[model samples]
Target: MTDATLAQLDALPTDELRDRAFALARQRRDIKFFWDLFTHVTHSDDNTQDGWIGSLDASIDDAVALWREVTGHHYGDAEPLVRAAFIDYIMQHGK
Candidate 1:
């Protein structure tokens, strides 16, 4: 995702974010990578960092929502569990 796209996404409401993400996920090979990076699952490098954060820089609200779905826990509510899962995903994927 480009900073421009992230800015566009950040401007959307949570629901719209989810809908757009899912819809794009279906067609985008890198959507999951972006989602993981945004949610802090994987290490973000220059190739993925700037745009990974957001077009205009933004909050993790939408990322948190996606995290909940991916882990079945409230966003950042279970700190250790969330961190563990985030790290585990990255480790398994070798990203």
Candidate 2:
């Protein structure tokens, strides 16, 4: 990622970061793909549903910009996988 991208991501709140990640993942894959992945990962598990929406509000733009840099592609091509991975990780790890 570029310095500017890293700076942007570093400035974002955790929740926003997560959101951007999820959005990117969704872009990479289809809704069904991400949904299935999420369901499979969270099955039989207690996943936290709070705080995520607000964690990265401050840095959403930067996070998204940084995400593009990290993936070397625009959101349309990379978001789904990024989002899915973020969701999967958070669902399994509570963060």
TM-score of each: 0.29, 0.30
List, residue by residue over 22-90, the lDDT tens digit for candidate 1: 444433443454455355532322453445345433334555454444445323444443344333333
Off by over 4 Å in 1: 1-8, 31-69, 77-95
For model 2, the superposed segments whose C-alpha errors exceed 4 Å read: 1-4, 30-95
| Residue-level lDDT tens digits of model 2 in 1-95 | 22324445545555565665556544554344334433443333354233332344435344445334433443343345444555444443332
How accurate locally, in lDDT, is each candidate? 0.42, 0.44
Query: What lDDT score goes with residue 18 in model 2?
Result: 62
Measured by lDDT, the strongest candidate is 2
| Consecutive 10-residue window with the lowest summed lDDT within model 1 | 86-95
Which clashing pairs does model 1 show? 3-55, 6-55, 7-55
**Scored by Cα lDDT, where does model 1 land?**
0.42
